[model samples]
Target chain A: MRLADNYEKNGDLIVTTLYDYARRIANQVTVVKDQGRDWDQLIDDLVTSKYFGYPLMFLLLGVVFWITIVGANCPSQLLSDLFFWFEGQLTFVFQLVQAPEWLYGLLVLGVYRGLSWVVSVMLPPMAIFFPLFTLLEDLGYLPRVAFNLDHLFKRSGAHGKMSLTMSMGFGCNAAGVIAARIIESPRERLIAILTNNFVPCNGRFPGLIAMSSMFMAVGISMASSSLVSALVVASIVITGIMITLAISWLLSRTLLKGESSSFTLELPPYRKPQVITVLIRSFFDRTIFVLWRAVKVAAPAGALIWFLANITVGEYSFIAYLADFLDPLGRIMGLDGVILLAFILGLPANEIVIPIMVMTYLSEGAMIELDSLSAFRQLLLDQGWTWLTALNFMLFSLLHFPCGTTLLTIKKETGSKKWTILAAVLPTIVGIIVCTVIAWIVG
Target chain B: MLMIISLDQLPVGESGIVTVIDAHGLTRRRLLDLGLVPGTVVKTIRKSPAGDPIAYLIRGSIVALRVNDSKQISIKPFSEVAINE
Candidate 1:
């Protein structure tokens, strides 16, 4: 063991010597052929060039998000229609069998409605976004994103690879926390894990996209509304990234103080991404995995929400009392009590926040499917929602604590109660501060 | 005598032969494992827009090294070395 330790002490020298010998033998034995066109280097030069690099990165990212928003709408509508139609059939059967009122309400109206809302609203975006993102990863573009953004990250005293993990956060914060494994430094990894929630994941994206589109539709033309909303969402993403850097900087200076570790990132040669493999892998791996988790959480949450909405005390249901209790705090944050309740209940999965809000607003035991965005907007308006409310809700969604799955992942990854708790607390504090400040100014 | 400079000081599109690596412990080992030994040819490819970590062609692969790491690697310009030869 001592001899092995001694060898390990001089491991670098030994590896250098071995490489020297291998190079010498290979140089003598082999003839090298020069490729006429070095396409890889050419593309790298263009993409990483000073003038074009940042623009190209933002443009590509914007295009992906734009496609996701536009492409997801039709499928989301179709799935919603099909699921509600199925819900109608189930209700018919329940009536035909003369099932107990409470049983039918809980099973079909509550649990089934929540599950269907989650699936229809959440699936199409994930299905579209993950494959597009995976295609970029397969094409070796993600590392270049890290490469371009490394300087900013380094300035914030975090590893450059934090950029890659943040990209994963766009899909899911739990996945993002796991991807922090790429950062070898414990300090930076913790920073990445704690701040990953700043980026709104796929679960939150459906809500953000919906709200932002509505926010833009007021004054914008139909032709430009989608584009404007895409830009709005993009800016929110940028804001989240800014918050990530700010918090990373704050952590390094205070709680997790350390010098940024040295890292050598290889800019792998871009490859022709295999389309078939990209689709299948992204579908089964990311879309299905995340959907399953959301579905699992949504059912229990649905039942709980139904119970809250159905079981009344005096004149109001439990949900109304809870919302009334939270009203002052929510009002301070430029949101209503129901919105706050939705966020609290959304702890399990962000995908169900909107549905919960809808269920509570109607004060019904079950969730109702909104026929259109205009009708949705009208409902919110009737409930005293304003432009500021929508804006704060979007901002809150972007800045708030990660969902329950992410907290579990952080605990498992850090294995420390303090850091896991900080991971949850840090972002929530930031969200509260931001929302309160916005409401104070606007109110 | 050829003037030796740190790798980060080498201009983009310039080629240099490494002369010494002034790093230790895991950092030193990592640099060596990446083929940054004495006499290896390294070329600066480009700079990221924010311009701290620079990409270089090392051992036929493009690798990005932060200024902190690259500044520790000393190199002699290949143009000057060829003239000396």
Candidate 2:
């Protein structure tokens, strides 16, 4: 009669008991338990909430940017001193060897100085920033960031995953392009690739950090100033983000289409990031690797810049004359020809814009000093700059073309020349237009 | 019922869990590679002040995606289906 009740085999109490225990063990030990009984519902409810979720995300974002800005300062100054001293020694060695004057000009003045900027300016911030950023990633905070903004991304007609890719863009646009591989729609992926230049990469960050600190945060309290500069960069980054959204919206409605994909997002429990592991991975995997890549490209670029500055065709070298030619257009955008030239040359690396500009303006064939941020500020002003100039420069820098590495990365990821070209060109057009409009309005 | 976001409408702080892995081809694989499985949670961390490819966190990694691409995802809150407690 009990057998008629089912496959229970009720008379076999011992076997039944063992079966129950085994099932319990399997559920507890082998599988991730859904103690989350209605986890799907719980996640959905929280993600969709109109009030609490988004503000928390903004608070976190402000926190991250604040930390990156604050943390990057002291080390930046220290690296600057060490590299400058190295440059001084290298200069003395060149003199002792009785190196040809032009040889000195090319290697010591042009190449080494550029390398120093790359090393000193680019390294510290990345060292301090990447690990901290990685800590956020490790703690499972980022997915929740995407979850909170999914609705906004959807309305913009872009893929939600673009949010994640763009975050990578802040570290380095090339990495960001690689990150774009996360978008599930081909059209959406294309859009992500095209728009990623909006975020300031490490190369671009020096410009942002230099300008914002000089112009915006000159006299604030010790702690306040750092936070202010970061907020400023984040502000530009936020603008780039907005533009990315606007462009994607325009693309999807007109060209790309389909729907936003539905995917599951899991927010892992927050854990203390293992510091040793994080430092090792970030230093080896990201910081040093990026530095090495920059150096490989930068050496050739250094030679090119030297040649461009020194080789005179008529009264000016090819680069100088070209900058002269570009000046009118640059003026239309509230920038001058030299700045435009710097952007074009800086395509190989954004890290050199300030140095290039100083070299071109000073006629010293290279940027000379790194004593203080104030000195950098003085150099820009001496070259016909104003607050409008600084503002426009920041905007253009924030919104301009992807650096050479990023462009190549886009090519690698898309495996298509057409998409890569589109990625490079679209932002330049937007940058010029946006900067021009602002320059006109503010002028 | 599920609502589709046009890339432009996604706000700075909104959050959503994936309801469909609806994108096709390589793009689909791209999402999956970032641990964006069908049941994963997503949150918008910050929008650049100018807005566009807002930053979002997926799984444990931070990724920035454009608003247009987010349009492909069709999501509805659990609260929409269940009575809110």
Candidate 3:
């Protein structure tokens, strides 16, 4: 210890010295082989080039989202059909046993239907999206994405790697919050965590896609409607990214004031993505995990929603009373009371927000699955939805508070109650402010 | 004569020998740990779309550094004549 103290070298000097020795040893022992062509450098040259980089990134993102939206439709329809068929069997079994109506309502209508709705609606897209995203990650493109978008993040006074975390947010916000650990600096990591909710996760994507498709349906060709909807969803994602940057800038300058930390991102060589491995890994690790959480939350939420729609007050159901109480505030945000109530009740899991709203609107004990986007749009239109309301709903969904799982993740990650609450409040406030302004403007 | 310039100023596709890393604390340590020590040959590979952070080849690995951080690294460019020699 005394000898080390006498040497008095700083950490940087020690690392430099050690690397110097290692480099010298490697130079002496290793034989050089000229591979002639460097594929990695060639790829990086194009990928990280100033002109092609941003366009390639956006094109890749658009293609992935387009593929996910188009590909999941058939499987989602099939899954819904299978589940509802099972529901029929369940109904038969209930009648055979002569179960009470309340028991039937709670079990077959409430819990089982809710679980099926989540699985059928959420599973197909998630199963498709996660594997595609994981393929990019496995191919080492994500770090290059961070590399490409670092300048924007740096301008926001946040670490560059926040881009990586934000991309993870597209999968799930809880996972995104966990991904913030890659940002070594505490202040910037918090910024990443707080701003992650601005990006709509997979849970909210179904709603956004449906709304965009429904909105695009009018005055557009059938073939191009999906393409336009994908573009609309992409634009919503861009809006979310802008909000993320703006909020990150606000937090860094105001609450979490600090200079942005230095980070060195190693752009790894792209490898041949293992197709089967990526499929299986993303299936179990992300899709199944998220589906399980959504199902767990959706079951009880379904039961509660069923009760709310069934239990009568004076003239209306309990949910109607709650919606009436929130109608004024919801109107200010260009949404009805039931919409706001759905958001609140759907806090446990975003996958059920639309289902809850539909159940309330129908005033039915069970959440019903519509056969087509037009049917869903017809229901919303019957409820007096305008373009303004649809826009504001998408905006609100994009900017609202993180779900319960994400809040818990923020709490566990930051290990501070203050930050966790701030994480929840900051976005919710932004969401409310944005929604209200848009509503007033449209009005 | 060799010209000394900040790493951030080295044009893409140019090679230079690192002279000094004028950063402090963790940043400096990270740069050194990535084998950016003096006398190491570094190549400016590509710039991001925004042209602020640039990728560099150092010790056979590609590492990206933002302009603010990369400016702290000083290097001596190898002249065309020197490369030919």
DockQ top scorer: 1
Estimate, for each residue in A201-275, the C-alpha lDDT of model 3 and write its tens digit.
988987887787677546877667777777778888988988888888888899889878898889877889999
Q: Flag regions of model 2 displaced more than 4 Å.
A: A1-25, A28-56, A364-368, B1-85
What's the best-to-worst order under lDDT? 1, 3, 2
Instruction: Write the residue-wise lDDT of candidate 2 on A174-273 in tens digits.
Output: 8888887776668888888888888777677667766776777767797888777767776786787788888888878876775565443444544668
Higher-scoring candidate on TM-score, 1 or 2: 1
Candidate 1 per-residue lDDT over residues B1-85, each given as its tens digit: 7799999999999999998887776777789888888888999988888787999999778899999999999999988899999
The C-alpha TM-scores of every prediction are 0.93, 0.75, 0.92
Give the winner by lDDT: 2 or 3: 3
| TM (chain A) per model | 0.91, 0.84, 0.90
**Which has the higher DockQ value, candidate number 1 or candidate number 2?**
1
* Candidates by DockQ, descending order: 1, 3, 2
Error of 3 at A354 (Å): 1.8
Report lDDT (Cα) of residue A220, candidate 1. Answer: 69
Q: What lDDT would candidate 2 get against the real structure?
A: 0.70
